[model samples]
Target: MGSIFGTDGIRGIYGDDKVNEDMAFRLGKAFVQFLKRSSDHPEVIVGRDTRISGERLQKEMARGIIVGGGRAFISPIITTPGLSYLVHANRADGGVMITASHNPPQYNGFKFFNSGGEKLSRSEETVLENLLSDTDPDRGLKIREEAVYLKEATESYVRFLLSTIPKDMDFRGIFIILDCANGATSSVASELFSRLNIVHGLINCAGDGENINRGCGALYPDSLKEYVLHLKAVAGFSFDGDGDRVVAVDERGDVIDGDQILIIASRLLKERGILKNNLVVSTIMSNMGLMDALRDMGLRHIECDVGDRNVYETMKAHGAVLGGEESGHIIFREHHVTGDGLLTSLQILFAMKYFNLPLSKMSKWMVPFPRVMLNVGVKKRPEINSVAAIRKVIEDAKKDLLNKGRVLVRYSGTEPVCRVMVEGKDRKRIDAWANKIADVIRLNLN
Candidate 1:
């Protein structure tokens, strides 16, 4: 009965109170009704990752779509971005991707994208939520239309990704390591790398439905880092469960986060006169050092809230070509609408080829300041500014750091926790300050 959509979409533990077959069916019917506003019999593309629950959830959703007089096209086991690309390419009315993204396999969710390959807006999501609440479960006439399987959906997406780079481009000498997170990209990343003619080694690609994001992928890339170092490859790329986010490692086994990736790509784009307005967009979670690096390069930076949707909106507003979060959701407006991990890996390769430098050396352009982040479990999320004690502590920390660093305290949109982050030149000072703020928040909220 609560709101279904979160910052990303409707996500929760599979079989939990939040997400189940009944909820998915309702969502499918609501989505079809929403689309009926523009079209008589809308066609929707439904896809899912490698989760064990994905098959049942998607089947239930397709059933609701059919009962609501809409056609459902299923692409079994596809990435989130792949679904987006298919929606745009196939000119479908809309699309639904069943995934939990970087979450564990036990959790599953749904992401809806419009025909233009963009995520549903806040208002659109609200309309669907309202429909779900009001619609009767057994009121609609259950039509018996079998969902059509889109056998070529994955192949089409692969072709699109290959066309992004130059046809003559060859990665023969580039030995790279890829960690597919044993999720959606498990079936696609290896093929793409192979077709590109790269000497690549893959890890964590053997998914058993329950193994997705199990101490692998972007959330846990220590093993990939070590492997990259051991093999002395050019670089290593790690993708999340749904292949919309990525984290990279340099040849030296040093991790390159989204901030560094943004800096590297933006610099290259600027030199080629492809960076629109010479500007970039990032979230508040990004390191302060990125701003300093941008200033040095004579580029402008804009900060938004902590979400890829927010970053994309700001990018569109300012005509920025590149934007991303520290969590590795990098969006290149010149390419796809949503984030694509495989495409991001290609861009990194393009940068390396153009610059003719190793990722470790190119990443040196930005020196990240020491950052400390702490999460405090909370019973409820009250406004941080309304708490006198929390506000005073934040103000004091900001004053102490002054121009040397920054402090940010915000509540998580998905979890019941308050995140406190402090960044400065001194590691010890920032760590202490971060814990101090966290303690104050816990005392007040928890």
Candidate 2:
């Protein structure tokens, strides 16, 4: 129960190795109490993915929510982005998404979103953490038998998904293929795709509870790629387990990543005179090609740390309308408070249709710079945060690159490793420099 929240939220392998029911209940209670002082008194919506433990964990979390004097309207097997949309759209006090997101099937988690339908900020997390630390662990256990809404949550989400899209996109002749990773969005993505009059190929559309995110969804999209090529479809989009991020495979069977998606979307939006400030915000993990492409289009580019939340922060601060991480966590500021993979994919494909260009042609807005990343586990996890030796390696690499290229060193938020990254036009040079930094970190920092 101690400090389970990471830079994102609480995530772990299911059962004893990870978060337990006791912890779930406590988090629920803690979240409820933390939000009680807000304008509304804890009318938090709750939702989970299609993992095997979703139902049981849902029950436990709901109980905790009720105990905290919060009414829990629990949704069964809903996508993460839908939960965010629900939180804000319904005017709920906040939302709790019980998803492990692209983690393995055996993992589960609890994510807290504020009234704005975005993930809680660092200050909010700190409040929750402080409350957890000061409270009695056994105090909130008695309220575990309270009430919750256990049905029909997915219906509202599906209806809203169809309603929120721009009225002009009609892909009547285009074919679409979607791989939902057999997770939460299985039912909704297909229905939405079909209603739009697009010829559709849907795979991994069945979540067996045991197969979520198992090399089929956005993370490993080879199967979708193969299916798209075989069907000769225009393009295919894949969603991760929780369905908040999307990746695509073009008609030529090449996998298109989040950077490419954002590039295409920005260009299209700019042309339509809808892109605010003519700017896009991306994380440091975004390819230099993406930055260059945005720059060439006379669009300003802002970069944040390597997370969707950071991108959102930059967008909010800079008045940008679009932002995302390279992992497909796109924040369409006009549409959502956070990343919505399915929606982002929809936006991209609709733009493609508007332009009537092949995915290959539409996607080639940028020439990707060669880059290499190496992660090294450390004996003392805090060394990545504190060690001077780690700093020297990055600074030296950056100086060496000196306008010709770039290097980035960061600690993994979900693991005890320091990541070393180098980027340049030359792949060999980038890899060599990345290895050099990795060697120094391995020998001296850790």
lDDT of all predictions: 0.90, 0.82
Clashes of each: 0, 0
Model 2 stretches astray by more than 4 angstroms = 1-3, 16-18, 139-146, 383-389, 444-446
Q: Alpha carbon lDDT of residue 427, candidate 2?
A: 74
Candidate 1 lDDT tens digits, 1-446: 44778889988899987679888888889899999999899999999999999999999889888887899999968899999999999999999999999988899999998888889988899988888777657635656779999999889999999988878876778999999999999888888888988889999998888999999999999999999999999899999999999999999999999999999988988988999999999999999889999999999999999878888889999999899988899998888887888998999998899889999998999999999988899997778999999999999999999999999999877667899999999889899999999999889896
- Tell me the deviation in Å of residue 238 in model 1: 0.6
Worst 10 residues of 1 by lDDT: 134-143
The digit string of per-residue lDDT tens for model 2 on 1-446 reads 44667767878778853477777777777888898887545888888898888877777777777877788887767888899988887888888888889988898888889888988887788898787665444633566345666465666777776775777767788887899998988968877777788788889989988999988998899999899989999899999999989998999999888899999889878888989988899988898889889889999998888777778888999999998877889888887888888788788887787888888998888788887978887765554536687677678778877886898887777667888879988777778889988887888755
Q: Could you say which candidate leads in TM-score? A: 1
Q: Tell me each candidate's TM-score.
A: 0.97, 0.93
Identify the runs in model 1 with alpha carbons over 4 angstroms from their true place.
139-141
